[model samples]
Target: MEGKTVFVDGALPGESVLMQYSSVRGKFDEGYVKEVLSRSADRVKPPCEFFEICGGCSLQHMSSEAQIEFKQSILKEHFEHFGNVQPETWLEPLQLDTLGYRKKARLGIRFVTKKDSCLVGFREKRSNFLAEIESCAVLMPKVSELIVPLRNLIGSMDAKQSTPQIELAAGDDALAFVVRHMEPLSEQDKEKWLNFAEENDIHLYFQPKGPDTVHKVWPNDNNDRLHYQLPDFDVELAFHPMDFTQVNTSVNRAMVSLAIDLLELNGEERVLDLFCGLGNFTIPLAKKSKAVIGVEGVDSMVKRGYENAKRNNLENVDFYQADLQQDFSEKEWAKEGFDKILIDPPRSGALDVVQYLPKFGASRVVYVSCNPSTLARDAGVLKEQGYRLVKAGVMDMFPHTAHVESIAVFERNN
Candidate 1:
């Protein structure tokens, strides 16, 4: 090993492997484990048949417990290197069922004439081509089992070549699939999908163009909405098929409970929820707090959030639309004061909104993040503003993948 750095894929920290270089750059080189001479104790046989070829999951080769520890280490390293700080206390990691937990995904579709079959699943590892898979184990069982059937269904259709992808979304009570078709479907093809939905007891939707063109195709009485309930708070959230919702429902429920506990509301405090999508956390926070104000970037989502609040009969919760990345300090909602703040911003982190923390005079802030580097960066800003990271921990929202979902509690310094 010379002074040059080699980036290896499919290699663990304590494994000895025969690697083959894939790319060599001026500063660093990239390689993959061609053969493992010595494997780590944490290595395990992946459960999915398509693990090696499909790019859907990366850490399926490692044990579940080991995966959590590795993610914790990644969080710690990000804090030390990017934020220049650490939490006063580390909370226990929140974990749940690892398999069949994904409730949402976008799968690629390709008709391979050579094989005289259709491939319906994730893309190939490190490639744009669709992976050849009959079924998937990571997706919710209802959706996973449909992979082969879907392939056959598409193969029978004349517009099979026009189909590019399938978007899946499952709520507590409903399963929905949005088939993205490049061309208009013939009546025969439409009947095929309708029968498929009827036989499988699943909802079918069609997307002829952009996301705005998505419409329900099956069950002429399509008034039913997709929803998930938080039994702890007696809150039910209804969402559009294209709306953003957590893939793992159990972990989401646990995460909301943990956030509420960290807030320690006494039914007399005012809470601020930023980047609140469909009022997932806002409605629950409203159950314990005196009042909750939710802010989001999208006008449609904000409108839906208000509808969710009304549907839940939660009069104390209000929603407003604002671009958090830009200056919104002049807005009425931004001028309001609160006792607690909760932010579940996108992967870019909440640096723009975190800067205005002092104005709210909130004593406690709960930050939920999907990306650790950005979280660490925003944490540093809060630290500079006299907020100490009280406790932080990771959530296994995405069990088999490298994505990290974490939450942190920051209390203002006296």
Candidate 2:
């Protein structure tokens, strides 16, 4: 416990490890654990064979229960240190399956001529080179099983060297992959992809250039849109391969239920869902509230949100596209007073929108966040606006990694 600061990888607090200095900086030093002289009781054998090399997960060595506890501590530390406030009540930490929960990921692809093979998985830890992995334990079982086949599939193609990455998205009942290729695919390559898709019963899309250039190549029927359902509210949401959706469907369902409960929506109240991508929360809230307005920054997602609402046979929901970081006081939708609000902003948090909470006259606000630091910063702003933090808790949306998904409720002080 010297004054010198050392950031060690693969070592948790209170654990004695033999670490090799990796770098020496002016302010701090970096090291990697070479041997665990003493192990923590919470440490467990990592499930994935590639956990040592792959950078997909950091806390695989920590038990799932301990991981959740660590994350909860981090959330509490952030609130107290950054926000200068604490919740009156701490909600139970929400959790689900720890393994095979990742439904979305972008895997790096590399064709190593020296090995005369293709590598398909996450990048090596702390390096840009792709990790050599046969299979991934974190990906959905259906998608994880395809690692070896995918590597072989790409290795056999002439454009294998040109392919750089693969974006994976798995819904409740469907799986889609967007192959990013720098060069055009030959006819033979197309045939190989078609056979793979047919054999796997999965959809395939090709990204020749950018994300917008992605186009579906298989299942010409045009009916296989990726979707996830909320059986509780009878709401189904459809999204494109590149659309932003929660990686864990089970946790998402539970999260939505918790958020709605925190809102205390009474059917007669109007609600606002901000940063409402694909109307994941908007559609469900509409079922309980009299009317719900969903606002998104992306035009395509805003349109898709409205479509999702209509598909669910809900007419009490409306969606608008607007930059949430900018002022929307003059917008017609802003004039509609909302009794409750649900904000699910990106990692940057909802500073821009939180400023308008007082003016919206919402008695209750539910903030679902993915970044703890940003959430704490925004929480401070909410406190300044006469809202009292009623309850806050962490959601294990991402289990092994350091990502934190949290929900906090703030009620306007009477």
lDDT of all predictions: 0.92, 0.91
Q: In model 1, which range of ten residues has the least summed lDDT? A: 217-226
- RMSD for each of the candidates: 1.0, 1.1
For each candidate, give its TM-score against the true structure. 0.98, 0.98
- Per-residue lDDT of 325-405 in model 2, one digit per residue for the tens? 898888899888999999999998988898888999999999999999989988999999999989999999988999899
Scored by lDDT, the top model is 1
Instruction: Name the regions of candidate 2 deviating beyond 4 angstroms.
Output: none
lDDT of 1 at 345: 97
lDDT of each residue in 1-414, candidate 1, tens digit only: 499999887888899999999889999998888899999999999999899899999889899999999999999999999999899999999999899999999999999988889989998887889988887888999888999999999999999899999988988988988899999999999999999999998888999999899999777786646899999999999998799999999999999999989998899999999999999999999899999999999998999999899999989999999999889999999998999999999999999888989889999999999999999999999999999999999999999899999999999999
| lDDT computed for candidate 1 | 0.92
